[model samples]
Target: MSTNPGRVKKDEGFLGKLGGTLARKKRSKEVSDLHEEGKNAINAPLLPSSAELLPEDLLLEENAERSMLDPTSREDPKFKDLQKVLIDWINNELEEDRIIVKDLEEDLYDGQVLQKLFEKLSGRKLNVAEVTQSEIGQKQKLQTVLEAVNELLRPQGWTIEWGVDSIHSKNLVAIVYLLVALAMHYMAPIRLPEHVSVHVVVVKKKEGILQTAQVTKELTTTTEMMMGRFERDAFDTLLDHAPDKLNVVKTSLITFVNKHLNKLNLEVTELESQFADGVYLVLLMGLLEDYFVPLYNFYLTPESFEQKVHNVAFAFELMQDGGLKKPKARPEDVVNLNLKSTLRVLYNLFTNYKSAD
Candidate 1:
C-alpha cells in the first residue's frame, strides 16, 4: 500500500503542532503554579526558626494559659499580701506626685509610674515622655526605663528576668519580680512578705506535640538571699572595718535631710546637735506629713530640757499619726543628742520619706 508522501508529511506536522501546544499549556500551568507559590511565600508571616526561639518567646506563647493561673487572678493570699505591701510602698514613693498604683499590672504597664519610681529611688531623671497614651508609645517608654534600670543594676551583678514585652503585656510574674528587685535595690522600708511563691503553667513543645506543666515559682527571696552578707550588714561592717565610710553615710543622710528641709529655710549641718533641740524634728515631721503643726502643739524655742523632751515626744506622736513605724529611741534620748537614738529616728524618717518632694 503506497500512501502519498505529502499527505503523510502534513499529518505528521499537524500532530507535532498539537503536541507542542499541549506541552506549552503544561509549562504555562507549572509556571503559574510556581508564581502563585512565590506570592504566597512573599505574603506569608515569617516565623522564628527553632533555634531562634528564646525563653521569653516561649513564655509569651504560654501567656494565655499562664494568665489564668497567675497570682493576681487566683488571689493567692500570700501573693496578695506581697502585692499589697509592694503597692503600698510604690504609693508611698509616688505620694508627692499624686500617682497611686492600685494594680501593679495596670499602672506599671504604661511605664510612667515605673519611671517616676526609678527617678525617685535613684534621684536621677530619665529622658522619656511624661505620659504615653498609645500602646506603642508606652512600650517605647518601658524599653527606655528598663534599659536605664539595667544599667544601674549591672554593677551589682543583678540578673534581670523581665523584658519590655513581658512587662507591657501585664505579665504579673514578671511585674512582681521587677517590683521586688526595685524594692530591694532601693532598700524600701516596707517589708515585702517573705518566701512568696506562685503557681505557673509552663509550656513546651516536644517532637510536634505541645506539653504543659504546672510549676511552683518563687516570686521573692529574702534580702539576705538576694544580697550578699556584706550588703545586709553594710552599716555595721562599715563601722567596724571602714569607719570613714560612716562619714559618707552621715553626709548623705544630712544631704537627704537638708533637701527636704530646705523648703522651710532650714539646713541640717550637725545631724546630732541640730536635731537634739527637737525643733527641727518637729518641723521635719510636719513637712513630711504635708501638714502644719500648730505652734501650741510644740515649743518653737525649746530652751528647757523638759520642754525639748516634750517637743521630741510631740514629734514622735506625729510620726505615729503619719503611719510611720514607732521609733525605738526614747524622747529623752533624742533630746540628749544621743547619736544612735537621733540617727535611728532620722533614718526611719529618711527611709519613709526619701521620695518626698
Candidate 2:
C-alpha cells in the first residue's frame, strides 16, 4: 500500500485531551482551597464580630434565620431515640432468653429424678436358675417348676402348651417374660411385705477362679443409683419354696405394664422431645428384664450353692406365698397399677426414702 502523507493531523483530538486535563486540574485546585479554608475556620478562634460557625450561605440570611448552627454542634434526637430503643430491645431480648434457659434446666432436672434410684442400691448380683435332665438321670422327669409357672400364667391369659422337644425352650421363654416383668417394676422397686429387695441374690463360694456372684449392668448415667447394690440376704428370699406358692401368685405384671404404657401414650400426645424419651423408657425396661430380672432373685446357700439351681421356676412362684401358706387368693384381689409420672421424670425424680442417709 502507498503511504498517504496528505491526511490532516488530528489537532482537535489533542486539544480535547488538553482541555479535559486542564478542567480536572482546576477542579482539584478549587477543592484544595476549600479544604484549606475549612481547616483555618476550625483552627482559628471565633472573632468578636464574626457570625457563628456556619456555612457561608447561612451568615447572609436574615437574623432570625441565623439559628441554623453547625449541624455537628446540635444533638440529633432521632439518633438518640434509635440508640435508646436499640438498647431497650437488646435488654428485653436478653431477659427473655434467660427465662427460657431457666425453665429448660428445671425441666431437665425433673425428668432425670427417677433414674437416680438405680444408684441407691448397695449393688446387684447374677441369679441363674438351671435345671439339667442329665444331672440325676431324670431325662423324663416332669418339670414341676415349669408346671407351676404355667399354672400361675393361665389365670393371666397366657397360654402354656409346649411340645416334648420344645419344653426346655418354652421354659426359657417363660423365664424371659418373667424377667421383663421384673425390670418394669425394678424401675420402681416396691416395698416388700418386709424390708428387703423383692429380688434375690444367689451366692456360691468361689470354686476355682470365680470370686463374686455379683453381676454387672450397663448404665447410661453416672448417678449414685448406677452403682448402688442390694443385700444378698434380701435377694435370696425370693427362692424360698417358690413352687409351693406358685398357685396362689397371680402374675399382676402384665396388667401393670399395659396401664402405664397406655398412660405414656396419653401424656406424650402431640408432644415432641429432643431426646428419644419413649425409646429410652422401653430400652430401660428391656435392660431391666434382660440383665436385672433373673438376678433379682439370686439365692445360693453354702449347701445348695454347689449344686445347679433347682426348682428355679418353682422358687419364683414360692416367693408370692410366705411359704407361710398354701397357694390361695390374696385377701385384696384388685391390684392397683398406676405410674405417677413419665419415665423421664421417674428416672430423674427417682429417690428412695430408705436409701437416703
Candidate 3:
C-alpha cells in the first residue's frame, strides 16, 4: 500500500519479458511451419512438364546405340583383313596420286574397285553364312541362284562358295566366290589364282519406309579378272583357251537357268527374285566382259575373233556330245564379232537356249 515503484517496475519488466518470449516462440513456430512446407513442396512429384535433355545425355544414348550397331566389333579375321587391305590400298593410291586419296569418301562410296576388293575380302570368311533368321530367308533366295551356278561350274574344275556381310542392320552384302585352279600344267591343279574372282554383291536396302532390292552403293559393279604375269606358253594357253572357257561357262549358265527356273523358289514373288537374276547376270557378264575385251587388246589380233568364235562353237558342240556332229564354220557364220555383239549373243543364248535333257 506504500507506493512500491520498484516492485511495480520489476513486475512490469517480467510481463514485458514474458510477452517477448511468447512472441519469439510464435515467430519461431511460424518460421518452422514455413520451412516444413517448403521442404514438402521440394520433395513432391513434379507435374507433367517438357524438359530438354542435356547434351551429355544425348551423346551417351547415341554412343550406346552405335556400340550396339557397329560392325567393326565383329570378331572375324577376314573382316579385320578387309579393313587393313582397304587402308593399304588407300595408302597406295594416295602415294600414286594425291588427288585420288583426296576423294576417299567418294572412292569408298562409289568406286567399284574398292567395293569389289572389300567384297572379296569379306568373302574370305564363311561366318557370314550365319546371319540372323530374318536375313537368312532373303539370303537363301540368293543362295539358290548360287547353288545353280555352282552346280554348273563345279564339274569344270571350278569351286564356288559364298558369304554374307551385314552392314549396321541396314544392308546385307553378299559375295559369290568363283574359284578356279591356277594350273601351271594343263593336267595338274596347283593353287587358286590371286585375282580370278567374281563376286556378286546384292545389296538389300533396309532403310526408310520402302525397302528395295538393288546393288548397294557400297558394292562395286566393276569386274576384275587380273591375270597376273604368266610364262609365255601359259599365257598363250590361257589366251587360246579363253574362248573355250567362255563358251563352257555360257553354255553351262544357259543350261542351269533353263533347267532350274522352276527349282529356284522364293518367299516373296516380287522383283526380289529378279534382283537375284540381275545379280547373277551382272556377275556372269562382268566376268566375261573384262575377259572378252582385254583378251583382244592383250594378245589377240583383229583377225582372231572369227577363229575364236568358231573354235568356241566347235568345242562347245564337242563338249555337249563326244562327237563333233556339227561342222566347224567360220565365225561370221556363227555371229557378229564385236565385243558388244558377242556379249549380247551370249546373254541372249542363255535367256533363249532350249535345254536338252
Q: Indicate which candidate wins on TM-score.
A: 1
Model 2 Cα shift for residue 123 (angstroms): 19
Report the poorest 10 consecutive residues by lDDT, candidate 2: 329-338
Best by lDDT: 1
Summarize candidate 2's per-residue lDDT along 269-334 as a digit string, tens digits. Answer: 221121122332332233333323243343322123112122222222332332323212111110
Q: What lDDT would each prediction earn against the true structure?
A: 0.77, 0.29, 0.34
Arranged by TM-score, best first: 1, 3, 2
Give the higher-lDDT candidate: 1 or 2.
1
TM-score of 1: 0.48
Residue 58 alpha-carbon offset, candidate 3, angstroms: 25
| Residue range 119-208, candidate 3, lDDT tens digits | 333333222232234545445533443444445446855533332222212221222122121111121111122322122222121221
Model 2 clashes, total count? 39
**Candidate 3: which stretches are off by over 4 Å?**
1-134, 164-357
Of models 2 and 3, which has the larger TM-score?
A: 3
Choose 2 or 3, whichever is better by lDDT: 3
